[model samples]
Target: MKKERSFHVYAIITIICWSLAFVLSRLVMQELSSEALGFLRYLIASLVLICLIPLLKLRKVESKDLGLIVLTGATGFFLYMIAFNKGVKEVNAATSSVIVATVPMITALLSRFVYKEKITTKQWIATGVSFLGVMIITIVNKGFTISNGLNWLFLAAILLAAYNLLQKKLVQKYSAIQSTMMSIFAGTIMLAIFLPRTINEVQGISMQIIILVLIMGIFSSAIAYVSWTKAFEVAENVASVSNYMYVTPLLTTVLGLVIAKEFPEVSTIVGGIIILAGLILFNSDQLFSKKVRIKRIGNAELATAAQVIRESFATVANDFDLTLDNCPTNGAFTQAKHLKIDLDKGQQLFGVYLGKKMIGFFELVYHDGYQATLEKVAVVPSERGNQYGEFILDKARKIAAEDRIEQIDIGIIKENRRLKKWYQKNGYEIVCSKQFDHLPFEVLYLQLDLKDEVTNE
Candidate 1:
């Protein structure tokens, strides 16, 4: 616990340095072009990292991982620096920080497609909220128009998100320092195109700007990455460390006022609030929410349950191209009337509630004294990734066990390998598969023995 707390401090230190960079970069850019500023800043960072290599005893990059390292350098430093420097010059430090704060959400969104990570429905809403914040900041000044600076900043956010994904892969095989050092080295090499201009700019640079650039390079670029990586290593998960980024905008705004004497515009404050709201909501499951409860939903609540099922299953239907005409019996097409019929026929319906809101639903059918079936197990599309499905399924298993059922059977679309794996992880085994002529896809049947003591209680 002490180690985790220390890592949290490291993460905060990194964020503080990053917040300072937003303000200091603006100051340095006053006298330097974006290209020169990026080149000079990273050049100093690369030299600092090189000097630490021997002290840190960093390992050499493997030949196979060289491509990935270079890509990280290109995206994280080379491209991101250019865009960020230009954007910072055009926008206030507060606005720049708020725009860049969307990196975590963007990274999460990318991970959904790249690594098959699950995002809850709340997170989807949060992503939309953050983007809406960005849109407001972009158009607040010039009604319905976006500035070139905002465009560059948005691109920078995307490039950084790509860098995060690449870096995450590299860190698995290499130390954080080694991964960061190599990427910085590669990025500095790419920025070498501005070497002549950087040298020319340095000759006439003011001492104040020089000191600011040095601070940004040594503290923000080199030390910040090192500390950020260390925090990730010691923290329980990536989200724990990454959540610290939510405060970047607020910290940058305060730093800008104190250090750079640049107060944020009204739009920046408003937009930053919205962006932070979304970020808070995105992480609310970890921060604000209480434990979920599984309850036996009654007939009076069948209509709401039906809506939850339809919304949840609609995503599956859309994914597999199953329409009402082609797959009318699908849960996406379910109505309250159907649920009533099921209830009258002795089927049990349950809802997974987070406080008063129902986020998931499932039905259980007892086939006999020793057998049962699980059906329509659905979690609201936006409410996924919280393990609500697992919660509901566990409850179903317990209910079956209490009723002395020997086994529980379930069916899923054969093409949904992710779902299949999820069930398998929960002690379900494939017993058989069937191709129904009426349905467009093959169905795989899985069964779970209630006697297995490993069932999640």
Candidate 2:
């Protein structure tokens, strides 16, 4: 369904809500113990979630996927929350958030080994720099020992990383909001086993603390997940969405300074810079090589093209809120679907090859009897900025002209400023904007109206 809410707003909401958890948990800690705090957080969240299930009309998980769902719930909530609460008891919220910032770098590396996802050299370098940033914050005021809650936070981080990966995978089949609700519910059950120890703490809680805990559960747990879940729907890669989380720590640190009055050490600031620098370098495409050969590829080439597209967009899965498998070229069911585009229907499947390797792939869809929609335009990470993107656009224009089509259109994320500007530079202008389902943002429909230009030829 099309959302009236902006995904970017939701993304920021999730971050701010989550960052507040680090501080809110601290407030609750004055009265409730760590385990009790964690339990109440989920319990309250579960209540709010239960109410939403009916309102949202969420789908129920299949019996077959029950086990995976439960495990993900455990990782996301039970283990992660308990450890996080315990760790936050020992450290300030800002420091805790900084340690948590290591999630993106860790998730990428873990995916490489576990899912066999390939990481580029630049990614590895970025990971190292980010890791160094994490180390500076964790080891500065206190040594690397468990005394300052580094061990507990470390454990919480590992579990959080696992939770995010599990959520990403599950969102492929399930709705993000529903799946998140289920995971929270599942984790609440696990935490229920320890309820007896903390059950007494609930009644004794002060009204101020009670109000804060409810806020955490309702906003951070229930609402923040809307963005988290919608991410997989919007982005082709998880990294694209998760990259925004880098700000969580920065925000938390600022909140800490202003609200909690916790002054950060110099090492903390330096580490934050290192982390930002690494992420910046990772996102930069320095390749000036635009020497791409555009051609129609055979079915034998689909798998290679698919892999290139997957690798090219793997970061989007991590950085963005969207799921990786949702891409037609990478999805389980659609990999073959694109390979079988009906040429007779005037649908052209094209590959952007650089020296025998298929670095980018796109489809010119001449369907619905209107414009040839240019779909799935992607350039491999290392080969971007080589004019492959423009090459695809030019090819689409040629095909549109040959087919006597009046328009060639492409849909791009409204938030992708650089790409949107690039498309404008190449003669495409936004004709319309509409909400796309599952995606958190609006898709701008841009077209090169070639009627007059083609007639001149």
Candidate 3:
């Protein structure tokens, strides 16, 4: 289904709800230990979801996929929660959140090796710069000190990274609700083995604390997830949807102002802005590239192009949330196109494959006068720090040379200053910056002068 205006409204509301969760969690923590709280939160979420299964009318799954699902549940859902909860016990809530915020960078790094996803040099730079912002918060505010005790937070961060990757994998096959429910329920079951320890902590809870915990369970765990899944469905890109998670901490800080009546320190606000800036760069096209490759259709390839543009897009309609309210597959195909261009150069499009699956794609226009413009290019969660993105850009450069194109222009959104600096390191120079008033974006044009460099070489 196409994302409507309603999805954006729901996403903002979900963020607000999630922001409040930190305040509630803070209060709940005074009464309950982290483990007890983690266990209980998932328990409520799972139980509620299970009760709704009949209404959801979910279908039975193949037995073969059960093991993968269980593994995902354990790593992504259960372990991540436990690690996060325990990490909070060792550090203040602010400190823990700062560390946890690195989840996206970690995921991008892991995705490269585990899933063989390609990332560009610009992406690694963005990831690094963005992570630097995270370090600023931790080192500047939290007092940079390490102890053997802090290992738990590291482990927790790793678990969180794994959790996100698992969610991505599972979301490919199952509806978000189905995947989330199974993982939550399975995770709840696995953690239930330790219920006795948590039971002992229940005696310490006051009525207020109990209410806070319930609210956290219902809103953050259950309701927020439903909204997140829906938001992801309608988002123009999955990464864009995931990027919204970076806002959680900002919301948390604002909520702190309301609930505790405590104004955030100047440093806190500064750090938050820096972090957001880095994330914008990290998430924007300066570090991430999306390409559509098509080819001239010979008689033999017309059927293949039909399948690529028409049928393949149809298959991912639900996954991509392009269903536009569950429109027919034919309706979905109507929105797709296969075009032929006339230019000084004759370029053909090739097949498009993501994670080894061929999907609908168009050709990269290679012409004498038309320059290829590159923009925000970030590594996915699992493919960071691997130099894969550089490799892709190198290939593009070679293609540019072959076609005798004048230059390649990449636009980095200004919100991501980190990526702009990173691009400088890779021989891309910023030529201009322009603001977009309607959207919260500013464009930074980085030009790679092939003619000048080629002559120098």
Candidate 4:
């Protein structure tokens, strides 16, 4: 109980620190340049990491991974800071906060493209809604101008998204403290290029700026960055922890009201609500299904698996069949043969479950030591729209990785252009199209190479 409570407390603290940093930076920027403020903020945070080096008892990382760590820092921390520092100057606090609020959706898109994370139609709708909300707010606030400041903020969002996905990779390999420290170290180095510009004004700056920098450096940057990294390391869904950032506009608005006596307009409030609404809709489990990448199947589950296969392939069978007599998925012996081929050939047959019931099943029949064919794919008739087909394809990819299989092949008939396109989108490329003796149409043979795939999941 206490441990979970502590996690929530720390997570909330991290969000509060980050969200309020916008307001704090604005106040301090009256006397300090953005470059100096960002550099100093992270410099103090980097020092905190330096202090924790011995305490964390961190392990040494690989050379190749270290290069990625450097890139992560450069893009995530350094570039994000520089862009946001320059960008925040032009926009109002609420506008800046709201514009930056689109990070989660952008991150999701990056994950889809860079990491091949499968998103459903419903999830796309959510992204659209959320994006609409952002546009509405931006237009209302300042007539949607893509000026230097807004552009910089957009660039900051892109850099931070890049940083986050790369950091996700790092956390899988290194401790949160270790990766966070290295990233900050790299970022601090990048900030050094601008030292000359900010250094000259330092002597003339007032104590108010110095005090705010100290507050931002210690509490906001140092503590907040570390804690935020830790949350990513420990949370089941990094998305869930990150979703807390949506609260930033609200937090910033309240802080602005209190600290600067600035109140938001009606349109800003309405747009902000819509933005939150889009985010909420997008994460509504419509797009990124928990049903994918989690379930596993064995022979014991064959009966349920068979039923799914039966319901799933019924349309195709009906289109081709004069009778169901020879259809493998139609009956006791044929359906069980699908199970037996896996048993007999040292192949794999698995079902993806949604909750306790099986929604889909796939068969991977080994061709040789290096290759396997996707023998069958079926999603239960009742469960088609949740990207269950994509889920099974993803599961097949993971099985290939674990079994040390080199390539997974799928033979789609030339007539099924839609399925062919779907396969292309899901990381499968058409190796060749060839005529098959048994089938009347040419088979479009597609293969997904598992050699370079990063994750079994």
Candidate 5:
């Protein structure tokens, strides 16, 4: 109980620090344009990250995965920063902060739509009620008026949503540190386009502003993100922890009144209160929880190995030219042969389960002398996009490292471009291709080198 309480206290501290960031942002914006500030902040943050990441610890991602990493960086960090910075310029700090706080909700919505995640009616109700809060705030503030200045705020909110979703997606593939570093690096590239103007104007800048910029980049952005990620790892519910974001507007408002000496209007306070209440109700799951089982299979547990393999290859069976038939009463048993092992030893399989039934299964196979292979990967039609696949892959990768596998490979059909691309996005390389096993189909082989740090793969 003491440990739990202490951890929560630490989380609360993190929340408070994050909230203060809003006020600091507003102050920094008073002196610098949002774009210029973001450019400088991320530039400095990237430099600090590079220096701190340790020279001997660099892990190289496959060349094929570079595009996806860059894309993740652009969407998650670069675009998010651009949107948040630009939006804050148009709206009050409190209002902008409230909108930005809806990032998780937006990600849930996008995941439901784009990834075909099965969002429940309860989730829909919460989303609707929360959206109502946004509407109430907007109406109470004023009728919707088309001002070009205010457009940036809404755009920023949308971009923040995209960034949040992208971050969640990419984090499954890479560690938080790797994902963050890549994002900062990519955002820095975008900021570099402004180098000429910034360098020319930087000569006239005061040391105080430079120090403030450094503090924002190094402390608030870099260190804060690392801390936030750590808190998220142990939190019971992410939305509950995120609900603490309701305090951000209050913190910024207080800072505005006390430090900036600007009195907030009635609408700002009223809107902020409404948003806070809505967030409370929307994210109240931590207060009263209902448990649901999600079935998972791992390679270490051999009891369910056959079942996992069957489910993982269900679709592949139909898609391939070979017609797999029911075997003898002996059931699914491994037949070891050179290049035709029924199942590799020490391989792990995982899948999503609901209640007592298995809903999906994905496979991870380890070769004695070669890199690990992630094969027979599939999710049941009903469970395809609920983030279960990503979870399985991540667990498989972690287990592969524990087993000392030097590389990871995934074999996909040449025609299944979407799956192939998804593998590439998750840091796999197509090292070889060939037609084998009498399937008449061209097989695309992928590899993820684990030669760097054992943890990097």
Candidate 6:
């Protein structure tokens, strides 16, 4: 709990620094071009990080990961800073912050494909709501047309998302400080291309502009990245830390009013509120308590289960290009008739419900007093990350134990490493793998000893 609280504090600090940047960058941009501002800001940030290397005892990144680190720096700093500065110059800090605040949702959406991370149904709705908010802002900002600045900002958001994924991967093998420092150094090198212009601008800058630029660079660019990376390292999940960004628009708005004397337009206000509403919904499960239940389903609900199974497996089918013509037995092509047949054969079907809605389904096919086959474990794509599959598996284990079944076995596609790791984490062991004539991919079989599970329980 203390560690979690610590990371939360760090994350909030990073957000505040970032929020301040949105306002301060606007002030600094009055005298500097976007390219010059980005170059100068991150040059200071890179120098600061360089100064901290020996003090922090940061490790050198391996040559093998150097390419990924450079890519991270390019996306996160070089590209993002240029685009962000351009957008902030064109719009109020509040509006710019709101648009950039979509980074968390964008990251989540991208992770669904890039990292095979599951997003819940509510999250999907939240994404749509947030984009609707962006649309409103875009239309209003340009009198029913999208502005080039907003487009740049959206592209920046995507680059930031890419950076987040790359940083996540780098931080696994490198310390947070090391990763942040290296990325900034690499980004600073790229930003150096604008050095001549930045130097020209700096030579004629007022002392006030100098102070503002320094703050933006040191606090926002350097400290904020380090703090955010530290939060990522300490937090249990990326969402926990990234969610703090939702606070950015509000903070930036307040800061904008106080520092820049800029009041948001009516559209900016309305659009920001809508965006925040969507963000709140995206994180509703964490914000509010949810009632989840698992129970045995009957023939009357088999049709619903079949529909859920088909929808759930359809994601896998789409991902792996499975079809009835190629893998006819794939669960995506399952029908109510097939489930009914399984029911008639004494296989027990179960459904996991969130409130009154069934979001996941699975089946247990008894083999003997000592064993059972756990098959067709499926969670609707949007409801997956909520741990509905784990809940169903837990219920299955309990049912198996009650039936005196000593072992439970299951099979999954060998290419599905994420699912395989999940099952393995839950105490399942790989027995073997086989390439069946009917299937296009190899199937890996896993078994869990219910005897040990019962004793542990």
Off by over 4 Å in 5: 1-17, 60-83, 107-131, 146-150, 162-176, 189-212, 228-365, 375-382, 411-425, 431-445, 452-457
Task: Supply the TM-score for candidate 4.
Answer: 0.64
Q: What's the residue-level lDDT of 254 in candidate 1?
A: 92
**In candidate 1, what are the lDDT values of residues 188-214, reduced to their tens digit?**
999999999888888878899989888
TM-score attained by model 2: 0.63
> What is residue 121's positional error in candidate 3, in angstroms?
1.5
Candidate 1 residue 351 Cα shift, in angstroms, is: 29
- On TM-score, the stronger of 1 and 5 is 5
lDDT of 6 by residue, 1-457 (tens): 6964689888988999999999998898889899998998898898888787656644445689999989988998899889988988988899999988888778878989997888889899998898888888888747778888788888888999889888877754455577778888888899999988877888878999999889988999889988887786565445567667778999999999999899998888888899999988987776563456667888888888988999999988998999999998999999989998998887888887877988888889988568999999988888866666766766677678767788899999999998898888665789999999989999999998765333222
lDDT of 6 at 61: 51
lDDT comparing candidate 5 with the true structure = 0.63
lDDT of each: 0.85, 0.72, 0.61, 0.73, 0.63, 0.83
Tell me how candidate 1 scores on lDDT: 0.85
Q: How accurate is candidate 6 locally (lDDT)?
A: 0.83
- Which tens-of-lDDT digit does each residue in 124-152 have in candidate 2? 88878877887776677668744547688
> For model 3, how does the per-residue alpha-carbon lDDT over 1-457 read when each residue is reduced to its tens digit?
4434456766786777767755666677777877788889888888777777766635366587688788877886678777666665555444445556666777878988987767668668877776666556556645785533235666777876887787766643455677888888878888786699889989867888888888878888888877777775454344545656777777677677678554555554566566566666766762354532222334344345455555534433434454444434222343223223211234444343333433433344543474765422323323335343444354455456556665778765565666666666455777999875543445678877665222211
Candidate 6 lDDT for residue 225: 84
Instruction: Pick out the ten consecutive residues of candidate 2 with the lowest summed lDDT.
Output: 325-334
Model 2 residue runs over 4 Å out of place are 1-5, 143-148, 231-240, 279-457
Name the runs in model 6 displaced over 4 angstroms: 1-4, 234-240, 289-457
